[model samples]
Target: MPALRALAAAVFLAHPAWADTATETAERAAADLREAIATLDQAEGARNRIAALTQTIRAYELGLTALREGLRSSAIREDEIRASFEAQRDTIGQLLAAMAAMEAAPGPLVLLHPDGPEAAARTGMILTSVQPALEAEAAKLRADLQEIARMRALQVSAHSALQEGLSAAQAARTALSQAVQDRTDLPQRFLEDPEELQALVANAETLEGFARGVARLQSDIGPPMEDFASAEGTLPLPVVGTLLRRAGEADAAGIVRPGMLIATRPAALVTTPWPATIRYRGPLLDYGNVMIVEPAAGYLLVLAGLATVYGETGDVLDAGAPVGLMGGDETALAQGAGAERPETLYIELRRDAEPIDPAPWFEQTREE
Candidate 1:
């Protein structure tokens, strides 16, 4: 009987208490880390891919400009224009393809029913505990996928826009070439045609007026950073990037540099762990590819010069959700060839038009 009892005890010892919770938590954490790494890779990869597309786009634009200018010096060559058009067409097609690929890249999402490690220990005491944890994890994954999907849609839209821009530019060049050809004695025509000269002046004035309207709007709205209390002294760099420039000053071009500039690096993974709302996700003059995120009440964060916009107006974005990807080496719409590198992010904080460094606020967030 004693031997029988000993055997029974040994059989019971083979099964440990419900400590599945701990195992589950460990598994989840590992998965989270892996997911984070993958997401970062996708983000950086998208930026790089977009850069290539931007380069191609720029080259095509240059070709178009040169082709148009060529018409001024020599007779318009039908074969040359057709050839350049074909090349431009191919570049545009490639651009659409690249943008599509970038949009498809995935990123991390919030986990809904994440099981705590204690779930493993309580597995024996609770009925259907594992099911709950599994369900929760599923929900979280779904939520994450949905958010990423929305962002992907925005990328698609941006690509569509570029395609449209390319087509418009192509058409304009085509029309201009035809006009020049129709008018023989081009040199004499240009010199003698008062009407044509007047038209050119009118076009310039129209473009200038449109630009002034935008500038006025920007000044009227005021900077978004005004609501936040001053934390100027200790603002930390959001990630491991260098300061390419500062806020409140122009870069020799007399352009209003809205905010501090920071470059987001690969090694420095800057993430917002909390929920945030996208205050603005549209283009602003001089602030190319910009996003304004409000992480909390009175706290505004601005990310500018992204090659692509990944968020939309009124969308509730989580902290660290991709606002945009950096790419394109084009100078400001107004800035001509005398521009710097195509990369870099311009960041800034304000309590109004008053300028303050964003480093301290970002540093505090990092510490938290």
Candidate 2:
């Protein structure tokens, strides 16, 4: 009887001990989304609207990522719980049938055991013992059913929250885009002539050649960003993403490039890591849309692979200024942020026309 009772208890509480951690993480993720929503609301009145919107968009991204992970854990846990029930289906059916048969029989009939009075008495005791175990298991089963319902509700609500966040973020993007366009307060380092840039672009055969041409075009760009050399290994990544490659590493196509690649979410915002003058901002050979900024006179930070580029050539931009967005369908993100990161940003740093490893400059995103 004890053996059977233990088995029933084990079957009833089949979820692994680790199940609560996932549930708690999911609850915390819900709280994070709530705070992100509040941040979005607070952004409306912030003095620096562009920076505010950038922060808000980032908050939503972090919240959504955590929630997505939570959802995945919840799904795995649910599958484990259901699988437990499925495995014990026969045992549960037998237990229920015995209980039903015992309930239907009269006391006298049950006492009339086929063997004898002594055997009948033993049978009565066993049935009485099983009663408590049966009740306990029934209660546990009810709890599990409730848990399944709760998970379903959580999933539905999480999806709803995701859609709302995505829509709000898109609105923030549009607002930020307009804000960058209307602003005229930024310092213009020098004037750019289209004819000159076109000629440079047409003549250049390699990135090194193109970059050298860009460096030579620098006019009296006032003063360069102060002490850019000292900022190495401490700079924030221009966008929120996971570092995919370091300089000299091979990429998906097995092509080695003197740049680092970062995997980013769809329509993810790209910002400047430091105050710098825009040397060039437009399409370049091989690379898609590109923005090359001069953090200092000889130091150029090149950001490539963008859907849309912002800011104009020779315009000085402060740190965290919106530079561009990674290419991806924004509407698809609303369905659910895909497990795969579809966008990639390529970053390269050069000093005095020599390629310097960009990894040393962006330690922040590297750790993440």
TM for every model, in the order presented, reads 0.31, 0.79
Model 2 local distance difference test score: 0.79
Off by over 4 Å in 2: 9-14, 34-38, 41-45, 91-143, 193-198, 215-230, 337-341, 364-368
Candidate 1 segments exceeding 4 Å error: 1-240, 254-258, 264-274, 328-342, 352-355, 364-368
lDDT of each residue in 126-226, candidate 1, tens digit only: 32333343334334334434434533443344334334444443343233333323433211101221343234334533322322322222221223323
Q: Candidate 2 versus the native: TM-score?
A: 0.79
lDDT for each residue of candidate 2 in 1-368, tens digit (9 for 90 to 100) = 56656666665566434446566687689779868977887786788887898888778877877887888887887887788789889887766775677688898987788899998898889878777877777776676777778788888888788778877788878887887788787788665655767799888687778877877774456765578888887898998788888889887899898888888888988888999878788888877888888888788898999888888987888887889988887566657655564699999898887888898788764443
Q: Rate the local accuracy (lDDT) of all candidates.
A: 0.40, 0.79
Error of 1 at 95 (Å): 62
Ten-residue region with minimum lDDT total, candidate 2 = 12-21
